[model samples]
Target: MSQIIIDQLTHAQKVRILYKTILRLHRGLPEELRDLGDKYARDEFRRHLQCSPMEAQLFMTEWAKYAVTITSQLGLKGKAMGTIGGELDSNTVEMLKEDQVIQLYELMLAAKGLEGDTITAKDIHNSK
Candidate 1:
């Protein structure tokens, strides 16, 4: 049953999984090295765009091994960007709410005709 399910995945699905794993690994890297790692991964995947199915399968196999090794080495475990239930932390949630409040306040002021060019400039200055 499991083997049948695995066999049913298309090549594109496998590639997407490999790509997302690489990106998650990249996220765990140090800030200074993140860009370099991301660029390398992106370039490598892009370079292989023209590969035959056998070649692509071989490439994905190698990358899957690499992803496992990198995850173990870096102690990275969690969902990647496209995974389900990717919720923000509490601090981020609060910050987003605060931003929404400010935007709503500005909108209210605009709707009331209280925000002309001069008033808008004053509001912006005061908000800062």
Candidate 2:
């Protein structure tokens, strides 16, 4: 979506569209990753349901970047089975508050666990 179109949307409209877009794009990922992405997005969106207006704006902005980055990665890779995560901007990480940073750290751990699981599954499949 263009900035012009985005500019016309109300906050609620933008939030709804961005959240749905995140879930929709995850469809291109592997089933396990897709399920994780869907659940995380849903939970995060719900957690922010009562945030302040400024907080909501920041949250939407970050997720919008995430959606675009993932879509770009999927396009470049011709699939979403591997290495879809681009390096996160250091500046963005530095800007996160303490609680947000903790949440992000937990997410990283979860993603790492999934990576190990995927590798183990592939090893077993190859062995068979």
Candidate 3:
């Protein structure tokens, strides 16, 4: 379908955009979904990369999905944290905070097309 094509393009663009953003954010795509975590996932990703093209495609697709989901939630969470007067300091440790984690997640998600534009707590609340 044409919609699917459009969707694919959107995702591709998101991935490219997020690639740079992720570098700045100090977060890489989650390793678990990318099969880059533990021995199994890493092995799987490697095997896919070395073997069947379809498998490679699947691997990338899964990573993109994971990235998007994580980023969107991260952004939403960050907005919430900001409301409470909490500020995130620069460091990987700070990434553990729910709000900071969410913002990182949002940046990734926007790159993947899971969500777009800036979101606010009210936007999230209204949606639900």
Candidate 4:
């Protein structure tokens, strides 16, 4: 069934799907590593943009397999990153609890122009 659907999709559509899936997987990574993962994924995709149709198809197939494996290994569901639709699921919510904390810490660091330092009361007070 899925193979039928895949066959029907245009090459561009397949590329779009693969790109979105990779981005979603990157989003689920720990905050500190997200940027690195995103850059690597983006560069790899860009590098393949000029490949022949057959090469593109082969790359997409392999990428799709890697995406599924990574998602499973990370205990993430298809809905985990809310990339397909803009709605969160229970599993996504649970996953976000820890991610949210890391995101917040990252945001705070960016806000204060600091790198890899825990925000302490003294740091906040000194900044003011």
Top TM-score hit:
2
**Model 2 vs. true fold: TM:** 0.72
Off by over 4 Å in 3: 1-47, 76-128
Pitting candidate 2 against candidate 4, the one with the higher TM-score is 2
The worst-scoring run of ten residues by lDDT in candidate 2 lies at 115-124
Top lDDT: which candidate number? 2
> What is the TM-score ranking, best to worst?
2, 1, 4, 3
Clashes of each: 0, 0, 12, 0
Q: Is candidate 1 or 3 superior in TM-score?
A: 1
Q: How high is each candidate's TM-score?
A: 0.53, 0.72, 0.29, 0.52
Model 4, runs deviating above 4 Å: 76-128
Q: Any idea how many clashes model 1 has? A: 0
Task: Judge candidate 3 at residue 114 and give its lDDT.
Answer: 74
By descending lDDT, how would the candidates be arranged?
A: 2, 4, 1, 3
Residue 101 in candidate 4, Cα distance off native in Å: 36
Q: Cα lDDT of model 2 overall?
A: 0.77
- RMSD, one per candidate, in order: 17.3, 8.9, 16.5, 13.2
Which segments of model 2 are wrong by more than 4 Å? 1-8, 76-78, 114-128
Residue pairs with colliding backbones in model 1 are: none
The model with the greater lDDT, 1 or 2, is 2
